[model samples]
Target chain A: TQLLEQSPQFLSIQEGENLTVYCNSSSVFSSLQWYRQEPGEGPVLLVTVVTGGEVKKLKRLTFQFGDARKDSSLHITAAQPGDTGLYLCAGVGHSGGSNYKLTFGKGTLLTVNP
Target chain B: EPEVTQTPSHQVTQMGQEVILRCVPISNHLYFYWYRQILGQKVEFLVSFYNNEISEKSEIFDDQFSVERPDGSNFTLKIRSTKLEDSAMYFCASSDQGPYGYGYTFGSGTRLTVV
Candidate 1:
């Protein structure tokens, strides 16, 4: 089974602090996606990284995919209370034919206190 | 923005009872999927549907589980016999192209509690 291991399962920081979450896997994937989920709600897509060593930025959130497509990272700058949530990383792979599947990480729970 | 809509935000049922979780995928999406997340556990893929048939499914999707796109816009998942272990947050998702084309858009999810 392909598994995505996420580091720093839980993190707490004061406002304005910076934090980074890591997702690693032994299997290579065609693409990787990041999602943030709030309580009582489903996960909301944040960003997707398709190319190896690719980097994309959204406001204060920076996402990077590893050169081997086996890992990814999310770095949040100047974190605020609004950024607090369960951050999940999912690896996308083709099962067969046109069918694709997403294997998710356990997720990192972040809490930003003002 | 378009959204995937799921019905009955929460449900409570007795063991061995049947339950159907309903969803309305995006109007333009062609691929549909079902996933479940147990409390304090990671989200796990259950099944993928396309062309009115099951394209792929995980081992967790056993005989007790089934999916149907009953109408043009609605996709439904039915569990014939609920087990305690089946209790989880079930999410329905759809993608316009494929996972590689555009990432899946998920619903708010239905929390199933088997008693």
Candidate 2:
């Protein structure tokens, strides 16, 4: 089983500050994904990174997958109050037609104060 | 802008009572799953259903738990007898095609409190 360990379980930052959250695992995965969850709402998909050493961007958020496929990171530039939420990382793998459910990190709760 | 939906946003039950949590997946999704998160804990996979049956389940999903898709739209999780440990947030999710080996779209969770 792949276990993802996320750092900084709780974070508090002022608006306009930048932050980076890390997700690390000892086992390699075929893919990695990021999600943002708000209270009472299920997690919403943020980004999926497939290739080793791949990088993807969405406005203020930037995601990177490690070359070893065992880690990933999410960097937020000039964080805003809207960015306050629980950030999660999930890793995926499969065999044949079976879609292996993701192994999720505990999560990083980021609060960007306004 | 489609999303999964769940009913009875919160449920409270006695330790020995039966409880069923319901979910509505995306219109065209082929794979469905159930996950749980204890307060201040990581999300844990409970089970994944496809082809009308369970495809995978975690150790946490023991004899006391079961899943059924009685109709075309709703997915349900049943606890034969509730336990205080069962209290947590239960999330239902769906994927267009097995997470595309990618990510899953989760529904707003159902909070279950067992007394």
Model 1 regions more than 4 Å off: A94-99
TM-score of each: 0.96, 0.94
Candidate with maximal lDDT? 1
Task: Say which docking band candidate 2 falls in.
Answer: medium
Task: Write model 1 residue lDDT over B19-90, tens digit each, in one string.
Answer: 999999999999999999999999999999999999989999999999999989999999998999999999
Across A86-109, the per-residue lDDT of candidate 2 in tens digits comes to 999988872322346877898999
Give the lowest summed-lDDT range of ten residues in model 1 chain A. A94-103
Clashing pairs in 2: none
Off by over 4 Å in 2: A94-98, B99-103
lDDT of 1 at A49: 89
- Per-residue lDDT of model 2, residues B25-103, tens digit only: 9979888999998987888889999989999998999999999999999999999889999999999999875643443
Residue B30 shift from truth in candidate 1, angstroms? 0.6
Q: iRMS for all predictions?
A: 1.6, 1.8
All candidates: DockQ: 0.67, 0.67
> Given the true complex, what DockQ would model 1 score?
0.67
Cα shift from native, residue B94, model 2 (Å): 0.4
Native contacts recovered, in order, as a fraction for each? Answer: 0.61, 0.70
